[model samples]
Structure formats: structure tokens, C-alpha cells
Target: MENSISVVEGRTLHEISLQRKLWADLTAASLDFCEDLLQWSSCGNVAVTDTDLDRVVDRVLYMYVSEPLAYWLTGWFALACMNLLLQGKRDIEVFVFGAGPVAEAAILSLDHGAAHRILCVSVLSRHGISNQMLAAKLASKVHFKLDAVKDRTRLHRAGFVITATDAGAPLFEPHEISRNAVTLSLGIDDMPAEYFEMLFSQGGLAVGDDLVAMEARNVDPLSLYYSRRGLKLTEHGRADGVKNYSEILSDATLMERLKNWKGPASFLPVGLASLDVAVAAKIYEMLSITLSTKE
Candidate 1:
């Protein structure tokens, strides 16, 4: 007896064929091979020959780039925030503005390692109730609060704040920021020009992953707005001040300097390709070891 397949099954088969062809082309070109294989496997493309799949896996192990970009980016940001928090007192209050993927990653990063030090976490978003409820389940020990962005008064209580939204305008003014707060701006235009001016004026530091790249793209709202207002970003030696993640991570004296900061310090991390590559390589190494152990 023969069996009949539904329209959905037929369509799925066609998709699988197209996906296999695409993966073959990508693998042949040696373009993001590990990422492509991971993606292909995710689609449950079982028709791929075991020999070819094994070869691809071996190549990925040799190349050492296997993890997703989001994972590493989250780790780097979290590490930077943790380092900054360590410079100050313990018992920190963290506030995340925008409940997007990046914000969720930051929340997870903070919760996993620093729960003991983190007294409370407040997530301000349009979907505050749901995010707050989800966060409650994820980390019961860390107190969670759901608040709207309009609650300006709550901003002053946060010791560590991270902005992870694509809003074209500033979310909060500089005056609302608490003294000695460690703020990391992950979104393109989530911070205002006044905030940058205030950070520099108060002898606090403002750093980025790559200021040259950021200025070249002209997507950073703070830089564009400040440039339009006749506030020279580079001429005032602020460009010289922009430091990358490696610099921040390697500098032994940075923590001590940060400890003495009298006002808020801001970090603007424009995602870097190197970070993604490094993270992928690390994950690949770990997976390779696990597979070898199983064999």
C-alpha cells in the first residue's frame, strides 16, 4: 500500500531541497561553513549524506568558528558590565530599558553570575508585565519590577543601566541618571547628546568599540546630533578617548580608575566582527572536545 502526503509535507520537502542546494553552494565557497552547517541541521535536513556532514563538521572543528554572534556579544557586554560593577560597591540595582533580545541576554548574563551582588532588576518596556513575569520565573532570588519608561523617578535608583532598544530618540535625560552609575548603551540611538556632554564634563569616561567606524556609518544618533550642534566629537580629544573592548579588558588599572569616578560612566559598544569570530571559535573548541569524549 502507498501512502499520500499532505500539501504541507510536499511544500516542506521542496523547502528542504532548496535549503540543501543553498548549503552545498555555501559550503563549496567556504563561506561561514560552520554557521551554515549549524543552520542546515537546525532545519532538520536529514537527507544530507553522513560522509558530507561529517566532513563539514571536521572542517568546522579545524576552522574553530562555530558559535552564534548573539552569544558572544552578550558575553562581552556582560563581562564589561560585571567588571564595572566590581569596581564599585556590591548590592547593585540593575535596570534594563527595552525587553528585546539584547536586553534579555544582558538580564541572563547578570542573573547567571552576579545574582548575589544584584539586589534587584527592573525592566522598563511597553510589555512590562509579561517581561517582569518571565524574569520572575527565570531568577526568583533577584527582585524584578515592571515599570513604564515614563517612570522617570525610578531611573535615579539604578546603579547599573543598560539600554537595548532601537528608538531614534533618547530614552532618558542625563539629569535622571544616578551619580556614579555604570551605564552601557547597546542600541544605536538610545542615549542623548546631553548625556555624552554631561559624562565628559563631569570628568567621567565615555567609551565605544570603534569610534571611527561609528562615525563613518553616521548611524549613531548621539554622534550625529552632537556634530550638528557644533559639538566637535574628535576635536575635543573625545575620539582619542574612545576605547575598544580589548583595551578595557586588558587594562589592569582601569578598575581602580573607575572606582574613583564621581559621576556616571558610559560604554557604547557597537558590535564588532572580531567578537563574533572569537566567540564562535571558543564554542567550536568546546563542542569538539565533547564530541571526542563521547567517541
Candidate 2:
């Protein structure tokens, strides 16, 4: 099958070339071969092969696609946190609810100098332990105090709360969150319906990449829950008061809405296929440049 991959950035979808058989045989691959592949793919000069196309696509999707997408999402979260800090004009405390891959990526993406403090809370002991190790490794770069805490008190203090878990229910009560707090929920069902209702009732800002797509897929936990309860996406649900990311133009505009926020502001980014393509395209460009310099 002939495939044309495209990445959506803001409102535009740009096409990207796929490197045919880039990992033709991983075990027998050499640095030069990898470098050449990168150079070719980056320039959109690679060819397509009919043989083992399915296998190639599978490997690329699972291995290459996932990481870049995670990184992209994390980058957005970082920017949002920065914008929130800029709007509030104060030192910001962050609470990460999960220690999973997405959470780790967000932690890695944070500007250490900008963040005042970071607290990571995990229901799973193993995740907490792993995040503890990760925090230690990141200590040199991170100027803030990174703590893996069992206490939930920090949740009330955090101005930025990120939920990246796979939990089936809400982790904390909506009332616990600070009035001016900004919460980014990447987990499917992490935040309960009540939380969203509170956000909407209080005139807090709600943002998402594509709430329509998430609801159509029936994969988003909040979307599914609200559907079962006979609520529409724009009424007391995940998409309630949600503005698409594409609509956001500048940090100043974001801050304008945030200035009057009397309750928890939220960002719910359900992973988009276009984001994977976008990140993959960026990697291709970088690899090409690196290979060219080496040669």
C-alpha cells in the first residue's frame, strides 16, 4: 500500500516522506547505514519498497512514533505551565499525579529555572520509586525542589497540576485544587465529571487539542462517562467550554482568559495521530542535519 504521511501543526497539515525499509534489518545495521538513512529520509529523498512493508510500518509506528508523540505532548504542557506562570506573575508549584511515561516526559520538559517546586504523587509504589530515581538524576539541571510525596496536601498548594495516569477514577476532590490552578489531564479517565462541572460553573478555561475526535473514538474516559450519563460534549462533559488548541494564537490571549480564572483551568490533550507525524517529521529534519554535519 502506498502511504502518504502528514502532520498537522496548528491549522495546517504538512506532508512528510516515509523512509522505506529504514530499519531493514536492525540487528545487522551499522552507524553509516543509519546515518545515510536519516540523511535521505530527512530530505524526503527515500524510496518505498513493497517487501515487508507491513512489518516496517508496525516497527516505525510502535518504536519511532510513540516517543516523539509523547515528547510533543510534554512540550505543549511545558509551554502551558510557563504561560500560566507568566499570567500569574509568581513562582509556580507543580503537582504531577502519575509517574508514567507521559509524566516523566513532562518532568523532563519543564524549565527547571522557571518552576519553583515540583511534587510527584503516584498511587503505585513502583512508579513512585522509579520517579524518585528520575528526580535524582534530574537534580543537577532542576533548580527547584523535586519531591516524590505520599501526602496529598501539596495538591491544594500546587498552581499547576498534571494528571498523566491510567486510573479509572478521579485522584482527588475538585475542591482541593487551588482557585487559580491550571490542570492538564492527559489521562483518559483521571478527572471526574464533577471536576469538569466545577470548572465550567466557575467560568474556568477549558482547552483541548480535539475534543470531537476524542469523543468519536470513544476512548477518552471522561467523554465516555459523560456520554453514558446522557450529557453532550459541550454540556457538563470533557468538552464543556473547551477551546481547540488551534484557536489559541498567543500567550497573551491565553493569559487574558486565565486572568479572571476563579477555578481550575484545564488542558485535556488526547493524543492525535497528526502529532506523531509532526514529531516524526521534526526528528527526520534533525537527523538529516546531524548526518550532513558528520559527513
TM-score of each: 0.67, 0.66
Deviation from native of the Cα of residue 174 in model 2, angstroms: 1.6
Candidate 2 residue lDDT tens string, 19-64: 1121121112222222333332222433322212243544542224
Q: TM-score of predicted model 2? A: 0.66
Q: Pick the candidate with the highest lDDT.
A: 1
Q: Model 2 scores what on Cα lDDT?
A: 0.55
Separate clash counts for every candidate = 0, 0
Per-residue accuracy of model 1 over 42-135 as CA lDDT, tens digit each: 2232221122225454453244332333532543465455665345557777777876656665665565456667777777776556556546
lDDT of 1: 0.57
lDDT per prediction?
0.57, 0.55
Residue pairs in clash, model 2: none
